[model samples]
Target: MNAKSLVVIGIFGIATPALAAAPTIDQLIANPPLLNAEMDRCKHLGMAANDDPRCQTAWKAENKRFFGNGVRYSPEPVNIFRNTPDKLVPAEKQQPIPPAPAGAPHG
Candidate 1:
């Protein structure tokens, strides 16, 4: 084989082992139990897990599992706290002032 062919073959040989060792998408998606276990472990890791690629990937998988592929299905929001009243209250009637005391001085 030519030197170029040998070099190409060597690169593929090294990469094939690495690719085989890495998890496939099907493997990732098919094992929710394993993913849950991984998520628990990541959770226990606390703040450190934020910097971890494995935890990040696991979180992405979890989000996709729950939310689906970026599509949102949110329902219209209802106004539960609205202050609609069944009936309006009318203002109380005011009593007429009695004629000022007859002897009171006029302004």
Candidate 2:
């Protein structure tokens, strides 16, 4: 009701969520952070934790849940190449190559 009570309530609300957001040892061990694409790819391969034994255990447990499971996933969420055959422009359609510079030997 009062400003002091309102402020205290608001502070507690924020603090409660902040506390919950903090990672527990169990969570940290189960889902170790991927430091880079290489690490993520390792996870994608079910490597779990190559460097950390704890993560390895967690990955083993997670892998067990998919016994006999055949995974179906795309390569990645990124541009695989500059252009594919369908998207490529033929050489003749492209701009002509610039003429060789003066005194420059032709290739």
Candidate 3:
């Protein structure tokens, strides 16, 4: 083989091990912080990221982390607004708003 070909082979032989040493998606997802950072990176990639395997894996991992085994957890509904009276809390037990001081500059 020519010297040029030998040099090219030598360079690839030295580089292949380094490339193999790179972590896989499972390894990256094992660490929560790393997974979160990867998710952020995927988010910044925007719509184009949907076609990226790394981004897809990161999103799936995040979904599993949040939703738990693909089952979505739906919490019971809560009524926070005062406009509607809540049946849960009895009106008698509810605290009454104290009357504003007489003639206090109206808001």
The numbered model that scores best in TM-score is 3
Give the better candidate number (2 or 3) by TM-score: 3
Error (Å) of candidate 2 at residue 9 is 0.2
The alpha-carbon lDDT assigned to residue 58 of candidate 1 equals 82
lDDT of 2 by residue, 2-107 (tens): 9999999999988776533333334544554522333455566674357655445454544543342465666764566756653555575668789986996779
lDDT of each: 0.75, 0.54, 0.75
Question: Backbone clashes in each candidate structure, one number apiece?
Answer: 0, 0, 0
Consecutive 10-residue window with the lowest summed lDDT within model 2: 29-38
With candidate 3 superimposed using the best TM-score fit, by how many Å does residue 27's alpha carbon deviate from the native? 4.1
Candidate 1 stretches with Cα past 4 Å from truth are 1-26, 73-107
Ten residues in sequence with the least summed lDDT for candidate 3: 18-27
Candidate 3, residue 80: the lDDT equals: 67
Cα lDDT over the full model 2: 0.54
| Model 1: per-residue Cα lDDT over 10-89, one tens digit each | 99998777533434334556798878877898999999999987787788777777777763755865556679555569
TM-score to true structure, per model: 0.43, 0.24, 0.44
The sequence of per-residue lDDT tens digits that candidate 3 reaches over residues 1-107 is 99999999999998777543433556666788888887888889999889988787787777766666643555866666868855656556668899986886768
